[model samples]
Target chain A: GQQVQQSPASLVLQEGENAELQCNFSSTATRLQWFYQRPGGSLVSLLSNPSGTKHTGRLTSTTVTKERRGSLHISSSQITDSGTYLCAMSNNNAPRFGAGTKLSVKP
Target chain B: ETAVFQTPNYHVTQVGNEVSFNCKQTLGHDTMYWYKQDSKKLLKIMFSYNNKQLIVNETVPRRFSPQSSDKAHLNLRIKSVEPEDSAVYLCASSPDWGSQNTLYFGAGTRLSVL
Candidate 1:
């Protein structure tokens, strides 16, 4: 079974600040995805990066498959950016998610 | 815009009650999955159907079952719900069963068992 671990269980930032979240897996990952979930809301896929780096809006996802690790960076965070950021990895079966990083942006 | 749609955004029932959740994906994906998110926000995979065929069935309780009539629809049924069953059930779909595919998730159904 693959295990995904996310760092900084909780993070707080002021508006316009940058945030970085880390994810590490215990096994080789064939796919990696970053998701955002607002309070009591559905999970929204942010980025899918199996290897190398990917960017969407103010978000950036970088994955090093060989290292079994990935990262999500949020730039110029806003109050609406407050939510839980989840990282999931999969090898050959269903994806496994980490505990998720709770982000709180203060206005 | 969400391509995956789930019915009954929320459900409330007592223990031993039977409950069902419906999920449909307009993305025309060949694989669908059900995941449970607990109060602590820990997400766990429960079942996955590929082309309407059961592919990944985690070590969940036997009372939990997944039904799929086609590649675009996947449903979950709980014969005897327990207090522990109170959680958010998310339905997701991917292009295929391949690990490299990205998953699109529905809004999810929040279950409350009393």
Candidate 2:
């Protein structure tokens, strides 16, 4: 079975600080995506990078397919950024998710 | 912008009860999926339908079933729910069966089985 593992299960940072999240998959993946979810809210796709690096807004994601690992970096964190960051990967079927990293940006 | 919609944001029922959750996607995606999020926020894929056809059915209990009337609509029905069934049911849609497309998720329906 395929598995996705995320690091730093929880993170807390100041408003102006930075945050980095890590994800590793057990097997090869054709697609990798990062998602954000507020408490009791829906999952919002942040970035989808199967390989190399990609950026959007204050978030950046880097994926190394051969290594089966990825990372999400958040810069200039804001209080509203407090939520959960999820990493999902798929080979040829439905995507499977990691346990998710709970992030809290303090004032 | 919230193209996927799920009905009954929250549901509360007792053991041995049956419940159904409805999901619709306006994104015109050809594939829809049902995922379960436990209290620990561990997500697992339960079912997937592509163009109104059952494509991927995980090792879910036989009491759980999925219905797809069209490519845009997929529903989940759970019979004789148990305490372990209390979790959030998320509906998502992608453009196709492959991994090239990104998923659009709904708000999800929270179920409480007591």
The local distance difference test score of each candidate is 0.95, 0.96
Candidate 1 per-residue C-alpha lDDT over B1-114 given as tens digits, one digit per residue, 9 for 90 to 100: 999999989999999999999999999899999999999999999999999999999999999999999999999999999999999999999998887768899999999999
lDDT of 2 by residue, B1-114 (tens): 789999989999999999999999999899999999999999999999999999899999998999999999999999889999999999999999987869999999999999
As a TM-score, model 2 comes out at: 0.99
lDDT, model 1, position A16? 100
Q: Mark the regions of model 2 whose C-alpha exceeds 4 Å error after superposition.
A: none
Candidate 2 local Cα displacement, residue B93, angstroms? 0.2
Model 1, runs deviating above 4 Å: none
For candidate 1 chain A, the 10 contiguous residues with the lowest summed lDDT are: A41-50
Q: Alpha-carbon error at B64 in model 2, in Å? A: 0.3
Chain A only: TM-score per candidate: 0.98, 0.98
State how far residue A2 of model 2 sits from its true place (Å): 0.5
